[model samples]
Each structure stands twice: as structure tokens, then as C-alpha cells.
Target chain A: MLDEIDRQLLQSYQRDFPLVHDPFGEIGRCLGIEEDEVITRYQRLKDDGYISRIGPLLNHTKVGVSTLAAISVPAAMIDSTAGMINSYEEVNHNYLREHHYNFWFVVAAKDNERVDAVIQEIERKSGTDALVLPMVKSFYIDLGFKLWQSTQAD
Target chain B: MVTDQDIIRIMQAGLPLCPEPYASIAASLELDEAELLRRIDAMLRQGTIRRIGLVPNHYRIGYRYNAMTVWALDEDRIDAVGELFGAQASVSHCYKRPSYPPGWPYNLFAMVHGRGLDEINDKIAALKKLIGDDCRQSDVLFSEKILKKTGIRLKNRSSEHA
Candidate 1:
């Protein structure tokens, strides 16, 4: 269960994390707590699956190139096919989203050539054509999500 | 010559929760602390680092439903309409991508997340109403399982440091 301070810690620091010598101490000062308390709460949150990370989100564009790709697979083959796709280090995310194209995943690599190579390799092995949809433009900088209102003692 | 890669490689595993986080990282990189901070700030200015902050697991935080809605919008109005869709509070990631015709006809992609079924449905309906008739066709994709994410196949076992 999250206390008021835990909720505040999660909600307030989604962006613009402190960049000082003692970041946890800095956060503690902001929330009227101590450095050790802030660190302990963040650690607890991670252990309990409340957060994934607490640091820099790099722009993938600056890092590499990537694409959104999908393949429609038979019900029986979904598991095997997903596993096969996941075997490649270039593939970053694989999700079984619904549709005729029921399996969607992303292929990210250091360059366009490598990204395309991975897609082709997947197609060759899977025997199903991939629907590649690369981004043309982005509309917003996702500053991070605002906390939804808690309904119960969670 | 402490490059961005050197700094990021150490920091990307998720900042160490210590009293002196950045200083510790800089020390590991064998570079001056001020130089590291300056480089990071410079990257932020150049849009290399989007944000330096917390990434919550929305599912754990009560946002149980995540719906990806795709709209087949006119080419000319995609810019204006995409902005409007992105500005919605529930929408997290929004992008304009090419649509393969005959079957797939969506150019604008937006994700809407909610706590439950009723709330998610209401949010989708509201988005359609917001877009009005410009939405020629639309579809929603609910993921059954996350086959793989980052480097972990999450039954929540692996140390997911994304």
C-alpha cells in the first residue's frame, strides 16, 4: 500500500529528476523527508513493481533507428513465432496485440541497414511477411504520465 | 574525451540510488563530475535526452488498460489533428506513420490508458468525438501478452531495468 509520501514521490518525479551530488537528498528536501527515507521508498517501489526505472530516458533517434513491425500468425504458431522473433538481439519489444496482425514488435538497431536486415531475416525464417510501419514524425514530447486518482487503500 | 556513450552506459542501468548518484557515476567513468553534468545538460538541450526522471509501471499504478487507437486521417490535417489527439490527458504516445492500404488504413497512432473497462471505453469514445468525422476508420489493439520487453520476458522474474 502506498502512503501519501510514496504517492507524491512517484507523481512528482516523473520528469526533471534532480541532477545534483545527492539526488535522493535533494528529493528528500523537496518532500520534507531525509535522504535515506527517499532512497528506501524508491527501492521499495522498485521491489514492489510500482516503477521500472528512475533515470534518464534517451531519445532513440539519437541512439539508433527502429520500426514498428507486425506479423499475422496462426494460433498454434504464436508462441513459437514470438520466441523466434525474440531470439534476435536487434528486436527490442514484442507484444501479442490483437488483429489479423496479432503479433506486433519493434526492431531497433544502430542503423537503417541493420534494422532492415533483421526484418528480412525474421520474414525468411517465419515465412510470414512483416508489415513494417516506421514513424514519419512525432507530435509530442511525452513528459511522462500524470498520476491517476487512487480509489482505495493501495 | 568522455563521450555520451560512456556516460549513458553506466547511467542507463537505472541510476544507482545513493547519496551521491551522479558523482558516483562520474567517478566510475573516471571523468570529472562537472564535465559529466555539463555534457548531460548539453544533451538535454540538443534533444538527445528527452527527460531525466522516473518511469512508472502504469499497470501497477492502477492504469490497467492500455488501448492503442489508430485513425485513418486525411494527409493535410494530420499535423493539426495529431496535435489535438496527443494533447489529450489519457493519451501517452502519439505518432504519424504510413498506412498499408486494402486492409490497414490508419496513419495516426495514439495510446489511451485507463484503470478499467468502462473508463477506457469512455476515453476512446471521447477521443472519437474529439476527432469527429475526420476519423474515416479506426481500430483498437489490446495486447494479450508481452512476449518480450527490452531484454526481459516479464513474468516479473527478470531484473527489468528499462
Candidate 2:
């Protein structure tokens, strides 16, 4: 369960986290709390798995390339197939879905060729044809959640 | 102008979590703090860096039901429909992707999250009604398990390009 301060921190700092020196201190100043207390609370949030990390969300397309790839694997083969795909470090997000194309994953690489290569590799290893869907255009991205609303409701 | 690769190399792993994070990063890259901030500001302005902040774990915060809902719409209607879905607060990622006919027919993809499946289904129904005849068919691909999730890491750029 998150307190009001934690909810406020999550909501306010989703973006534009202080870039200056003593960022925690800066945040403390804003929240009317001590720097040490802020750090402690942040650490607790992270430890409790509420916060993944305090860092930059890199724009992958600006720096590299990425594609959403999905493969239809038989129920019996799902576990082994997912394990094989997950072995590749480039495959960052792998999820089991409800469609015929049961396994889906996103591969982020340095270039288009590498992205294709990963798709091919996964197809060969999984023994299933994979559909590689690269984003033609992004209408919207970076969907950060509103934690405050959930906290308030609770 | 600083090369994007240089900026990526410096900031790929993320800014250090400490006092003077930018100062340390600038020092490592042999750049003045002001110059580093200037480049970052420029990137933000140019849409290179979408955002810089703490990414919350939605699952931990009660948004456990998530789905990547894909819709098959006329190519002409994609932009308009995409814009509509994109504008919604529930839709996180909306994009136009190539649709392979007969097997995979979804061209417009939108990801939505909720506290439960009922909520997700409600959002999907709302989107479906909004799309009406523009959408021929649609499917919700609920995320059953997260195998791996991590920020991008630019592998040895020189080697890759070379």
C-alpha cells in the first residue's frame, strides 16, 4: 500500500526528474521533506517493486531499431519456444498472449538488418513462422500510468 | 552538433543516481555540464529523447490486466482511428504496422491496461463501438507473462556498423 507522499512522488516525478545535483534533495525541497527521508522512501519503493528504476527512458528508435515479432507455437512447444527466444538479450519484452500467434516479443537492435536477423533466428529456432511487425508510424508512445488515482481509490 | 551516437553511448545506461548526476556524466564524456544539459535539452526539443524519468511498475501498483489490442481497419481509416485511440488516456501505445493478410490482419495496434479483465474488456468494447464499421475484426492479446523487460542497450556500435 502506498501513502499519500509515495503516490505524490510517483505521480509528480514520472517525468522531468530533477537533473541538477542533489536530485533527491531537490525533490525533498518540493515535497517539504528531508533529503535522507526522500532517499529512504525511494529505496523502499524500489525494493517493494513499485518502482522499476530511477533512470532515463531511452528513445530506442532514435538510437537503434526495434520490431514487434510474434510466432504461433503449439501449446506443447510454447515453453521451449519462449525459452529459446528469451535467450537472446536483444529480445527485451516477451509475453504469452491469447491469440493463435501465442508468443510475442519485441527485439531492439542497433539496425534494421539486426532486427531482421533476430526475427529469422527466432523463426528457425522455434520452428515456426514469425510475423515481424515494425512500427510504420507511432501515434502515441510512453504511456506512463497515473498511480495517484489508484492510491486515492484504495 | 554532437552526434546522437555519442549522446546515446553516454546516456544509454541511464544517468547515475546521485548528486550531480549530469555533472558526472558530462565529466566522463569530457563535456561541460552546461553543454551536456544543452544537448539533452536539444534532444528533448527534437523528440530524440521521449522522456527522462522514473518508470513505474504498473503491475505493482494494481494495473495488472494489460492487453495489446489489435484492430484491422481500412488503410485509409488507420490514421484517423489511430489518432482517436492515441488520444485516449487508456491507450498507451498506438501504432500502424504492416498487416499480413489471411493470417494476421491487424494493422492498428493499441495497448491498454486496467485493474482487471472486465475493465480491459470494457475499454475494448468502447473502442470497438467507436471504430464501428471502420474495424473489420479485432483481438485482444492479453499479456500472460513478462519473460523479460529492460531498457535498450546499444551494443558495440562500432562493431555493429563496421
Off by over 4 Å in 1: A149-154, B151-162
Poorest lDDT segment (10 consecutive residues) of candidate 2 chain A = A145-154
lDDT of 1 by residue, A1-154 (tens): 9888989889888888988778899989988999999999999999999989877787888778889999888899987898899898778788898788988888887789989999998899889898899999888658678675552212
Runs off by more than 4 Å, candidate 2: A141-143, A150-154, B1-17, B24-31, B156-162
Worst 10 residues of 1 chain A by lDDT: A145-154
What is chain B's TM-score across the candidates, in the order shown? 0.89, 0.85
lDDT of 2 at B89: 75
DockQ of each: 0.60, 0.64
lDDT of 1 at B97: 92
In order, what lDDT does every prediction score?
A: 0.83, 0.82
Give the CA lDDT, 0 to 100, for residue B92 in model 2: 82
lDDT of 2 at B45: 73
Best by DockQ: 2
Candidate 2 structure lDDT:
0.82
lDDT of 2 by residue, B1-162 (tens): 556567766776655655577888888878888888888787877777777777789999899888999999988999999999998878888999999997888999999999988988998899888878998988889988887777676665665645
